[model samples]
Target: MPPRSGSRAKSTGTDFRAVEPAPLILLKGSEDYVATRALDRVKAELKSRHPELEYTRLDVSAATPGELSTLASPSLFGEPRLILAEDLAQMNDTFLGEALQFLEEPADADVTLIFRHSGGNRGKKLLDALGAKAVVVDCAPVKSDNDKLDFLRQEFRAAARTIHPDAARALVAAAGSTLSDLGSAAQQLMRDITGDITAEEVDKYFGGRVEASAFKVADAAFEGRTEAATRLYRHAVATGVSPVAITAALARKGRQIAALVDHRGPQNQLASALGLPPWQLRQAAETARRWSPRAAADAVEAVAQADAEVKGLSRAPEYAVEKAIGRVSASING
Candidate 1:
């Protein structure tokens, strides 16, 4: 799957299969196995329900716009199939315009067509048009520690293994959040350990402790710890974090801080306003303690400037990002 572009952009994962008796579904998110795993489980259930199902995978990346029109055709063999178009985002405008027309009246056959577009502006219009008829979901990057842990549990289940709770936490923190990496780490752990893997076994093979700690970048910046934040920002950037990505992180944090001090009503209401779960209120409260209205206001301005810089309005994305970090850190600390 491709990566999501811009805020609010949804990611597409694997194809979706129907329940015993239901319409086709869509699970949108990152290249994470969660969505892919959902597809797998759906297929598993579909098999027992309807054994005659057929599956088709198509890579639509290099195909010309005219070629895309061919996807609407029925399968050569008369069988139920799940068709996945892997690179729908790369499809040309001509293809997208044509797609908009077909989405309105899709073929109601035994086949289900799933278009997996990681995401971007390339086919925004067509995708949005299919929103009501088709499921248009955003597969943003994972942020919650719990979500990552749940992903780890799913991994263990796939291996026909069970891990201790503490061990799962260790794997999440030690392995980082990417699905492919987590799966590899889980397999190695399962293979290396003869029996059910315990938390103790995790410490021996995993090695991402320091890397995941880079999340400290946001913690320090929001708390106004300029020194720690600056050092961590440099380290994260040196580790290959893009200037644009770093700036986006700041933008996300800034929005979070702004939501905290939204004094329009009881602070509890702020969670929904921020699109964060209720548990985030604890962290928001703590982070808000260090933030003044003036500081949050300034941080917002800084992110706006950085966005322009990284987006090509300015020649120096790195310098612009550094400036935003400094401004936010100082404001939070001051």
Candidate 2:
């Protein structure tokens, strides 16, 4: 986890572009997107160095004993080889025994072995051995919104394009939480939109997507824009947005405001303590300033009622959500 060359790159995060071809490289984690990207980077690097590189992909689960040794052994053509051994987490005993043996005396400099293990304790011994010898690339899950935003930013930066923060946020909200979807959406925007991407452009492209609409309603409600919140909530329902989704967004916003309402620490410390990104914490703090403790409590109750109603407690889910929006807005105003 060395810092990448660029100033914008994170020191602790893996930069696939900076990954060099090693005798043993481990792409470890359950995040397929990251592992795939890291593997691609390694392949690209090796391909650049040796245009006639012999690439072989082996399914470790199906591989036989001594198969790795046979592949890693020098070929007749003398071409440098890159062996990608995948599914190490489900590796067979034959492959495991041979892999451990192979590690004792690794392949020649001309042959590189790349292993992909997608979590679990399937082959802890081999994993431990590989951990000691391999150049490990973490493919951990990107779960939080903050991490997703960072990913979107990286995607834009890598393309030599810039995205406005609001634009990034809008894209994340609209694209949902899937990394692949976000990547695809970002790629589409980068290819279609000229210059720096704006919030207007993201809305123009994905305005019909209802995922962001719920959050938009919550935002307006928290800001005391009752009319705007009501309008947005109605429009979201019209566009087929789920009432549960709206309630979930409102609950999340309520929690953010509640967390910040009585917080009495430095902003940075609070952000870290709450596992919130600084930007999100700052936004929550701004909204929290207008909210008394009682108002915050009332908003929580309102969101809970809406949550229950949306999940089969009320006959008219739409009305329940609208009522919650009104309560939130009232709390904000008072």
Candidate 3:
């Protein structure tokens, strides 16, 4: 959830992220629909806490910046209001100036401001200021393959349906990664299956789930017991996880560990800041403990080189990923 800055609207009840500096951020990199859905969930949570909260929704392209700046003003009803700045970056500078000023003080109107920016940091100075006065979050995009799989798992869980991992992957592949496609597929599958969405059902409705060619590459790279990292790199290339994805993941994880070590920040807070789900933190902590800062730095460099090779230097992704992972695991485990 993004940061939101507003006074306690004196609702009967609500959980508006009791964080000190509230900056309502739509997750960076998430599809607009997915981000919006996340915002909706936050609203639901808040509603549960404050039943009398009011809402004002505006289209980004249509609403000028002035309108956004004033979104939090108190109304005659005296109820706390929430403003949805949809597609905020679409507005012109005429509105941006006023918007930034409003963010500076953001009156005590018993309202919360939700600013959603796409990845680019256009007019971000004000956002930076908000970070000090409110919460600042970067909602990054999710990977198509893994992200979709995660989304499916979440959806199925919500619907009280259990889908095999393979089944869930198939749905994502066939349905495409877009929300419209995935959501429609899920709804139809639920209707058809009427209960548990099994692998057999996936085969029936979404077609047979074929082996993902990238698995061999991913599996071999992680096993650490072999020199097959290079071999699997070739297989990953044959399929479509993208060679860069493999290298990037290794580099990203290494960098994350390094950040944790260097900052020595609070464990739970660091995990939240790093965006790891609660479950992954312990394993990551253990990994960090065993890894010297220098080793982690070298591993990050190796991954960077591999990323350049596979993504920019025309090297085979399999070779790049294989080599990068081997070096990383060696350093991490050594």
Which candidate tops lDDT? 2
**Candidate 1 — which residues are off by over 4 angstroms?**
1-27, 42-54, 64-69, 75-77, 135-138, 143-147, 153-165, 184-197, 204-334
Backbone clashes in model 2, listed as residue pairs? none
Q: Best to worst by TM-score, what's the order?
A: 2, 3, 1
Question: Which tens-of-lDDT digit does each residue in 119-155 have in candidate 2?
Answer: 8999899887777667788777886656777888888
Mind giving the per-residue lDDT tens digits that candidate 1 earns over 232-273? Answer: 878876764455545545666677788776555766677655
lDDT of each: 0.62, 0.80, 0.58
Q: How many backbone clashes does candidate 1 have?
A: 8
Model 1 residue 254 lDDT?
77
Please give each candidate's TM-score.
Answer: 0.46, 0.64, 0.49
Which stretch of 10 consecutive residues in model 1 shows the poorest summed lDDT?
1-10
| TM-score, model 2 to reference | 0.64
